[model samples]
Target: MKSLLRLTLSVLIISLVACSILQREGRYFSHPSTISKVDAIGSIPVRISLEQNWTDQTRMDFWFTSQGSRIIPYSWFMWLEQADSRALFRDAGHMEQLRYLPVASSAVNPAGLPIGFALDTDTQTGDAWLGLTCAACHTNQLDYQGTKILIEGAPTLANFVLFYQRLVNALTVTGKDDAKFERFAKRVLASDYSAESAAELRNSVLQISLAVAQRQLVNALPATYPADFTSYARLDAFGNIQNAASAFALHDLTNRNPPTAPVSYPFLWGTHQSDVVQWNASAPNTPIVGPLVRNIGEVVGVFGDLSITEAPWWQRVLGKKNSYSSTVKMLGLGHLEAWVKDLRSPQWPQQYLPGIDATKAAQGSVIYQQQCASCHQVITRSDEGQDYIAVKTPLIEVGTDPAMAWNAAHHKANTLILEGTKKDIIVGDKFSVQAPAIELAVNGVVGLVLKNPGEALKAGLIPEEHGKRSLLADELSSIEDYLQVNLAAREKLTVATKAASLLSESELHGLVYKARPLNGIWATAPYLHNGSVPNLWELLQLPEERIAEFWVGSREFDPVRVGYRVDQGLSKFRVRDDGGEVTPGNSNLGHRYGTELSDQQKWSLIEYMKTL
Candidate 1:
């Protein structure tokens, strides 16, 4: 036992040392000199009005409320530095440098931790944790002539990969450097500062830092694969989520797969109303259960604590199942879903941008009906309960990159560890030795929902029509229905594939990306599912004619082009498609619908899109 203890300690020390070395060598910390120059480039004062249904209080709740993701202890995040320097990691001045929008402290956000950062306190332990809310990735700000326009539900430019890497680096450094640890301890413990407390804090920081570092290694693309960075405004969400649930939670490294298929974050405006969501339309948005399951899965992916373990002997004897535990906040997730149901799309800011040319817009409206209206439907902004079933266009029909869809549809994982566990602790089925990664992820999320019945009930998971039924029965029915819908959607995609029989099952099922309503599409730049096209002007041109390379981290908008300005020297996130061997997730191809239009016709369509 003593020898084993020594071995474990040695391995941990070695890992921490390696992580510290990697932090020093890699671009994990931002230099103070490289702070963004966006604010210094003169300001444009303009009155902004967003046409959204939610009130000020709702928006505040959405922005700051926690979804039970605990990235780190709240106090540590408040005091950590940039690894090599004493500069605060959460400093607003360097927010733009990290591609996150900076916001002032308000009544709702006393910590002033950027737009998406939220404080979650453990109800049992009273420990405050810092985690991200949906707004971190969904809310966006565009700089038009030094005037910032805040758009709810739009994809943000924040570089998630960079943010996470820097955080780990800071924690690793604080653990290794005595001076940094002393300062961090002082800030975190203030009144309770003691030698024993300092040692305990150091151990906590090192353990979490090491764990996150190990997870990053598991999610990384194999050394043989090309370096495919997710960069700003994009994330391989499904890939990461599956990895967290199957590999990290299950303690099975072999279940890990490279998170190579990063896609642009979808806007949330009409998402709740849509029958399906996600780039591939894998999730079914069925009333209450649908949104709750989807959000819980998202929370799991974004550093939410999830643990899948063997069922206890007592549980087994009692026939109770599901040993899956998670820190997912059920009521918070439900509130967020409710808020999103009424969140309206941002209309064109006519006061800030050029006025629409009525003649051109009218002509473009006709072209839209002829060329675009079939797949991308229009939605009524005010209709909160309107059902908008998204149209799924096959990958062959809309020739965009098939990587994202393919990966989600086909990625498999070893479920041997969960073999005897109920497929969903609440309802139907049981796990086999092997299953799709998505299946395991769904199972994990379902377990979380079922485990917290009281929270689920409070979160409005029980539908009005099902109120008469027992909570367990209603929850079980919802899970079964949701699973069936997901299975049916996958089958539909598989059946619709026109690919040759020689193609794999993964390729067949991945042959579709959903076409959603284009309302507020103008705010979501670098178009297409993978965000390969830089602007609407270029997107209207042939895919072959589009710029092969452009930077993506800038928030400065080009109103004329209807996208963010892509300046090579100003941004670090350079998206390239040399047309040799297509980059796994960054292919700038397909969606040939409007590319053949005349320049005049294309410009008209662009003007018309601004109205949406």
Candidate 2:
């Protein structure tokens, strides 16, 4: 009887663990929606046709869908069954916050994938792998009653923290399952393997999965990061990149700082034309080099082939190194950048929303020019018939929350290692390129190397290009050999050199934010650098009157408020006064422009802004 009970208990434990592995929910199925085809309805003038727009969307779809060799082989996520992956997706609770859209067809993506995910073939291994793209965080949808508004430039609402947590949980659960081991091994390593090889591969995958899960656990401990380190829609964009790049290059996880410097994702619309981009106005915004470096940085952040590990070098030398593959598709990235330049600001749907009062808008336009034009107006220049926006990188002190600026000012690149030596470069950490000309030189030369490895080999660029690979200028030479090879690249390099000539070396470290042209300002809300304010109306109020605490992450449009509706209870952010100074990154203080204006004046200003 005792032996029978013991057997029964063992059977129950197996069933429970099996159920945990098998249970899948929240699987997304693609369904066609008319949201993409909706008319601009007297918004901004579109340069491209709706069909062409759809084609651009298609290009965007491909860009977002194609896996760029980010993340690791045999991730716990790769082992998850379709149902289980879906369950993890659903459990993340991002349906409303991130405003995920349904896809049009199963033919486009198998497993009924959501907007952000698509199966990509590993270039070397010829195996299918899942990776993330720009759409996961960049694409946004707003529900205006029954109408769905698709805005591409606004910050994402997805809860990445939760998604990461679910992934860790999946890894933890999978690690404890002996029965699931064979299936995971076949899927990740090899289907037809000798018993010995399979055992080794299974153990390798387990080791990787377990290590990742352990890291996730360690990161979740409150002591790992700041107590106030909570990322909702906004992420510590620069800090995460720094940490990831450091981790990838060094393979030393202990030194990586937690991505605690959270800031709102700046909208991309009209950014290509800016003088200097990034929230902190750190990078040079030259047409050729700016976009190239920016995209490279982005791809690296998103897990593209930016790994400088020995494995990538080995793969580059040989065809494949074990299961790892690294390919930097520079031309493809150039195409993506060129495509993004065509993206126009979203037009305010005057027909769908309440039509703007034109007369009042005119009056507000007068007020805008009087009170706001000095800072917000676009500066243009024409030299010998060539016209361009004069990059006016003015650091205005409008008394908005200075935390982002402070954080930017204080941050340093302490962990970066110098190439060909154990010496680490003691450089100021920033989101922008520190030396624009140097960056262009490096990118132009290195980009060519990555583009044509055979030519690079023939040209004897192996040592210089591959010997000490990094994002710095030490390994890159200013000599004619690499730079003079490509005329177009050289010309662009010259152009970048001239564009950054006016910038002083000290200016590169300036923590000032760029005042972007307010073309579609009404569409992007939760104003201020940190996205602390919830609406334009609130933004116009005095610093004291602005709600000290509020929540973010809702797509329900409050057209009158000129921002997404925020419910204090349901919102993702809750700024509290802990009696001590508000956390540096979380403060809702400053940027009190136009606070002295009357209610009617503020509304009129908002109305005028919608037309721009």
Candidate 3:
């Protein structure tokens, strides 16, 4: 009986492993090796003709600069593998297979890590770590007749959820398999390889793996609803950031909420001057504190280390206030913001794609003035000091997906241990047990800024107009003003939740999705705030006439439609919009503004938009 049981257990383990592999195989579609190579012979460098202050070197810096986010230890990421195979996980070929843009090995990126993957080192400990930079989600590439055209600041088709899941699986396998652990240890500690060192490394891997698994559990979308799953080009950034700040940082697991509202990554070209950022327009772009605070929250969400601990007895006795400690690189964030100011929107590559018909474009210009100009205002891409504010179209008016905007406005969390903590460590009131997730995030940012005031100042946290700045006085005032603006915006959103009868037109506008300038709208497609409508042609159709379901994760351009070719390519992730409860976050409804136009007029408008 004992011999039979041992054989049965062995068979069961093998069966389970086989099933896991099959599941992953079904979910992820690997691209062919040929697809990774750019056919440079016929390719044209696609970019706007407008001259900017920054050079290509500056662009590369923006692509690779680290923001102190440590997704995993540097050695582990360098030598990790897939859960089921000996193949390296971060291999350039494997990353390309997953749709991550490949970068050649260089001094700046000696490992030849994919674009946006960077090395971050601890200033005090001299320990190196591996993490993602902004380019991971923002850089894009399109295939036009086998020639690849790189578009900076455009949304990438990389599968973020799959990438993270694979990493977690790799860590788990390395911890369990003795052979894998031995190999990983040897590579990580080549000079000091020993049983003792291997054991230590294994423990560290297991602990980190366990922590990552817990986070995935807390943030995972409902399995019952397929629409909530984040595929290529979309992420519920707000939800994830909230969970990171209020749940993980505070060590309150119950405070977690599933990240269900996935939206396309917005292009960064004109974001520097926009009055507000984000799909829901939740973040106000105040001068000094605005962009810095927003970037800090993003880094924290993306594996940046943040610890909220009780103040030491000596400090409490000495009247030194408590503040959250974080690994966010403040100066690095400032540099990124400055670089973004110089980014120009990409124009139509007439050489590769079909040229715009001048006559149709002229006709479309008239239609644009009548239909689109009110919301998506025309802008001069070359203007340095252009003041462009995104028009906040109310949910009831534009009627796209409401999940993202709704959650941002109303998601509340239990403050737990943070109940009585100062709302702002430098100066402000205390928090209550029940607070909005945005409030908690703001408090976390404020605490981190106060904890490192010198770095914050050097990072340009104060406006230059506030000359001869006192760290405590000017910085605190600016932060407070910024905080008030955020809080006031949140308040409007909260109150707007009341019955329509009780709401004024202005109050109703609080629940909105911002209509941004469409300078590069042709390049950033899968239209609407939710990214449900696949292409411009379908976007101009009535809600019911639009494609009910389509595949995403393709880089092949559909020049005629001005979006990616949705019929097929690398990934098989289906984006559905059946207009039912099952597809809450993926609804391709509303935005009925120009659906009544003639087909010829619609085509004309699309032609004109390519010129923008």
Candidate 4:
């Protein structure tokens, strides 16, 4: 017994020593400085808006131009700049690589930054970070014949997964090389750093790199392959956001679920007018608060600073002594929502896609009014003069695919959000459906911090007040106050704003899809909620009659088909016919509403839709 005990002690000591050495010498390093800030920047037309109205155009331009968050720091993303010899990212013809970037008009920032990135200097550090904005996914361009028609709200074809995977791999590989680390340090720090600062910077970049690499590895594993390896253009947006929120809460990779049910990105042109938003139509589209919550969740999924490090019980017990850290810029959310609200649907260009007979379209309009107006028409309220789609159509089984709906319906968000009681009374009572506790909690914390900066300073939530913190807090508080006022004045409104105000949480999670106004439906292809059907014409056919499988992520527009060009060698991603390739929550076999229409009638309907 004595000998065994001595051996155990020796082994334990040795293990601790090994761990300590690994911590001190491991290639992965993390420092607070390495987590870059996404500060706001001056306007520099990364992409020009197609909108003709100056006010609306400006907002649309900014909306598509700015990055809402700095998910990856500029230095780490452009790590190859240290080489300066080879063309890091380039393409031969059509400037395909540059043109393919989600940035507007293929224009770079004034700093000659990459597409889909905006340069913003850290308010305190004077260091610039590349931030990604709404345009990365929301903006899209299509080539009709030889003319490039920039569609502001169409789903993007940018290969975000590959871009991120490459980024993670590059950063991790560079971090592992000590010689490379010296160059990275010099490049990222932009000045000579003390040994401590150098170590901190290297550690910070390594930590993020390793985390990303591990996630990519996990996602690539066979168990997660179907869910994670989604095709270009389509992504499991909500599922990933839910997993990200879970990861933020647990601070561990285990919390993340395999992202399944990759759905097409829904255009945002008329989202503000919807009674409830989301592919599944789960979230309420409250006037001020709802948009705020949705945007906050987006920022979190994209590596924004808002996170829940410890469980609520732990947080309650520890109070200011908790082990979590969160930094949020909730102030800008209202502005973002306001800007996006101004976005109008892209009008179909008659000049490019000519040969539409006005007589046929007029006949088609009569067909649309008779056959489709019941569900697809937008009604303007006589009393309020406000326009809204009248129906939040129930979970009618139209059988195109049930995957996205099923995932949205069956999502176990109880663990991801506050349940039973202890919900933040301020925001929770106002809305439901996982009310974005982390965001609201962060807002509540900001409210508290603004009131007592000294207490927050003591708690180490913020550094010394450089005016930005206080200003941001005040703005966030005012927004919060505005939401509260709106909630109180809900009775005065013609439209219900809260989720509970319109439908219960269970009802909100129903297997139904909204029958949105198909004004620009011609622009949005790969139809159905899951994007199973490739075109309006395809959508009007019987489920089995439709193309069983097709390729996505091609920007070549088919005016005749009124959808994206889909052929064998056309696109980067091949959407399989069988459910073999598609993850859970994606099936292309429902919504047989207009399928029974005669062939000529279907053509007429298509012609009419394009006019809208």
Candidate 5:
């Protein structure tokens, strides 16, 4: 029953819990560790998972959850991972921690700065884990293909700074000055650096080389940080989000507190329709009908605990419920409850993604297989690579190998630890790095990676661009189920819609597991876990060698189109520091990387990708 809840959190197959609550219906506090993660005891109204709750055509909640789903204080999530062996799920803890960074005072405009960027000093003893979260990723932004966006799955404040600087550079007044860039980067980096240094030693080093650049950026900005001007200020004031959004805003809080319905994305392949379809979309809304898998799990922040379900969970590794009852301090505040609540965060505008050219996708698959298959397992096509999945694939940068993938993700994720510790890779709270895997963190998956990078990856655990250790291989597997089964369930509706011309057969709409068939690889760029990148041609054009700080509004060219001026790229780059000598940033985004990719290959890949 315990593993059931864990299984539910590990995948996105089916929705199990509602948006407002934390656990599945009838399930109580059930994290494996000292800090248990459960929903409010009988909190919400209807009982379905959130993904279905919102994505369903009705968009109705029989039970009313408070804010949208950001509540369940992240420290609670950290404990959930911790219960599973925090060191093994190192990066996962880092990521989940961000979701619950405390509001500094909840009394001012930027009441919630998130522990990472808060102006407070008392955070040392607060959820202390919250400070650890920022160190887990935000030393700087990940410059994928020269674009200044943060790593897709990992939300970083550095990207916001790069975006701000680029915008300032575009303005005539700020364009002429290079000093600010250096000043800005450094200050943020320093803040992050100082925040992450801890008393303990590590098992391995997972570092990012943002040390110098950080110094340069802060030194340049006059108003610098926490000022009314500059988006950097917004990041300082608002934490890792855009405009007025906070990942832990009031909306996110309320929904997670007393969820409206059961919202887990449980897997449904093996179960008999009668046996597994309780969350049906029929008049009664049974769960079974046409589900993705027999497994009742989820991918979003949805929760599920089989302890509450009719069936019994086979794996019962966790022993007790004390973890749920324990109080973890947060944001320098004491006695934080594991109780789920709602935090209403800001919402990004929903701009529908226009469809990509189908023809081009076909052309992209060949390249995709060659470059991407090493990490992503092809579920639809044979290993020899013969079939055609309609959409071009290539989103997940991880595969069936969990041990190794976790290691790779940790090296990238725990850069602050790498910088601060510069030594041993801490495995688990009790064990150090062992023969197979490298324990990367004292508390979570970081230790697992440090202990056995290879083994972890083999198990199929890799961080999504957002830095959560959910495997791409499994996601692909479920998507197949979701695509085929979900469609089958709605087959009658689809047929009726076409027959009635409510929508032409060709003009139909449906959800696919969040991936495309990647046979046509080249045309699918810009790449991202989230659809943040724009075009393939632009991706191919970026520089290969450097890990840059993607600046959105620099004075160079905008490889990806943007309406703003100063859409510069890597070419005209220059950085100054130390003795004030000018050094290069990225010359191009990532064009130079595909040295093996010839003009014909690149073109052919692009052409082929569209067909998929």
Candidate 6:
């Protein structure tokens, strides 16, 4: 036994020594080393060439003419430049207040944090080398909130180069060229612009930065505006700013260029819409956010040679200096385009459980008409003269505000019966459903997020469809029957309707009005018909009363503007110029979460609604 014990001890000691040696020397994850050491080992600096049809001349033409095809990605050099600048613009816009007047430095993403790297090696820079890769945008610095939560991107907007110039200009205008200005500009903007002369201003890096920022903003619009876009801002008979036609409309794919308004602007489609609100957990989705400047540092970082190590297959293909030489790069680019094609793809509802009750809904319907019908008519094709959010009067914070408390009063419409005692309201026995299958359909719809990535790409995953499809015909009939008899009939419910004071038809579709629905309904946020809105939850929270917030040019939801939301990397901002005073697809639309209900009525209705 003693001999056996000695042998075991010796074996253990030998094993420990072997492990220590292997830990120090092994190439595969040698603690101090890196995963790259074993998994992949080649550095490939990407090489880019302008697509044959695209030349530097084309880029110049694109700028002055605003030509469609000429300005877009088919021209490899232009595309690369545009993509990088775009990434940078978003960073800058978010980092600083680009839209609002009191444009202040952001507390989230501070100044420069390695947003873009200019490749400048001998024999490795020039027109062919001057394009942006993945690292241009999309990279995020996780801001440490605490041990559990980490938020990424600080002063989360543009880089120091862009922000500094902007700061200098604003400061020069305000004449607050005090010590703070100097310190802020030098520390944050990182540019020198103290000359009092006009020539000095012109010669300063500040000027160059401003020029770049201006060009970047203009270039953010896609090369081709869809035909549906309409122009609204124009010179009226009075020679003042008047909405004449839709500012942006969709056009043919083969159009010579994106249609121009005397005053051009991006279509705010993909902005928040109400159609998808049934999706709650379905709020902000991560897939919606594409690359920020730093998103793909690994993919777009300085490549050492014509080789790929830690890249997806496609990046590896693009990394090959000869990628364009081989058709492989083309194939890879095509695939990548498809993936990015639906950046604002509607992520199906994560939990679309519309589970509305019928019997209580039946009883509740009567209350809905008495209280809500005056404002939110069940009448068919009714046109209330308010934008979606405006008419709904959606408050930014639900439970936080006394008037617009979302959780405090859910069933004001009386469709929802508060079942519990006065202390705490419970709502199960108040409303009963003839069919419980609504939850099944809602579930199925919500399940799609996990089920069909392909269908989502096609934009077929509407939350309403799930509601309509989820319930059986009888179930819908019951719910509709309850609503119609309760809310639609206009008998003695002598409630005075609030007449909407609207701008003219042209004005309604004008840039200002067309932009109404986009305030803060992030559930449906994404590229409108023009692929404009990018943040899902952010769309829902847009404070329409504050016009400048809409102009931030990036998608982010503010709870102060939108009452409810969840963060999941949502995307989109599509707007339909529904001709009525309100935006499109919203009329006496089906009553889901009956917005027609007053604040109190909505509380009652929502309370009753949750039981369903």
Q: Distance from true position, residue 209, model 2, in Å?
A: 2.3
lDDT preference between candidates 3 and 4, better one: 3
Candidate 6 lDDT, 252-356, residue by residue in tens:
111111112211121122222211111111111112111110011112111211111133577548631111100011111222222222122111111332234
Q: Which candidate has the top score in lDDT?
A: 1
Kindly report which residue stretches of model 1 are placed more than 4 angstroms away from their true locations once superposed: 1-49, 224-228, 420-422, 425-430, 461-510, 568-579
- lDDT score of residue 37 within candidate 6: 13
Q: Report the C-alpha lDDT of model 5 over 463-527, residue by residue, as the tens digit.
A: 12112322323454432232233334433322332232333323312211123234223212224
TM-score of each: 0.86, 0.69, 0.85, 0.72, 0.27, 0.23
Candidate 6: stretches off by over 4 Å: 1-94, 98-123, 126-594, 597-612
Model 3: per-residue Cα lDDT over 1-612, one tens digit each? 546534543443343344334323321111111112221111123333223345879877987899878776665676787788887777766786667877665656656677788777666545566788888888888887877777788887777887888888888999999999888888777666788867866766766676666666667786665632687778888888888877767766556677888888888888877878888777777566667887898898887756676778898797654547777898888888777766778888788788999999999999999999999998876663364778988887887878887777667788775777666544456778777786787778877876766677567543333233334334455445555554555445445443432444334345778888898788887788778888899999998788867778788899899899988865443445344443768788899978999999999999999988
Give candidate 1's TM-score: 0.86
The order by descending lDDT is 1, 3, 4, 2, 5, 6
lDDT of 1 by residue, 1-612 (tens): 546544544565466455434433422212212211222111222324476777877777898889988777666776788887888887775566776665655655545567788877666555666789999999888877767788888898878877887888898999999999999888777666789878877776776687667666667775645443677888888899999888767755556677888888889988877888788777776655667778989999987767777779998788864487777888888778878877888888878777888898899889998889999876656553476788988777788888887777667788866786666554445777877687788788877766765666556553323224334345554444544554455345444332323367445433678998888889998788888888899898888878867888887888888998888423433345344666767777888898899999999999888888
Candidate 5, superposed: residue stretches over 4 Å from native: 1-355, 370-440, 444-535, 542-550, 553-612
RMSD of 3: 8.5
Give the TM-score ranking, best first. Answer: 1, 3, 4, 2, 5, 6
How many clashes does the backbone of model 6 have? 121
| RMSD (CA, Å), each prediction | 6.9, 11.8, 8.5, 9.4, 21.9, 27.1
- Those runs of model 4 whose alpha carbons end farther than 4 Å from true positions after fitting are 1-49, 52-68, 79-86, 89-115, 120-127, 177-204, 214-229, 309-328, 378-387, 413-421, 424-509, 568-583
Best by TM-score, which number? 1
Q: What is candidate 1's CA lDDT for residue 143?
A: 78
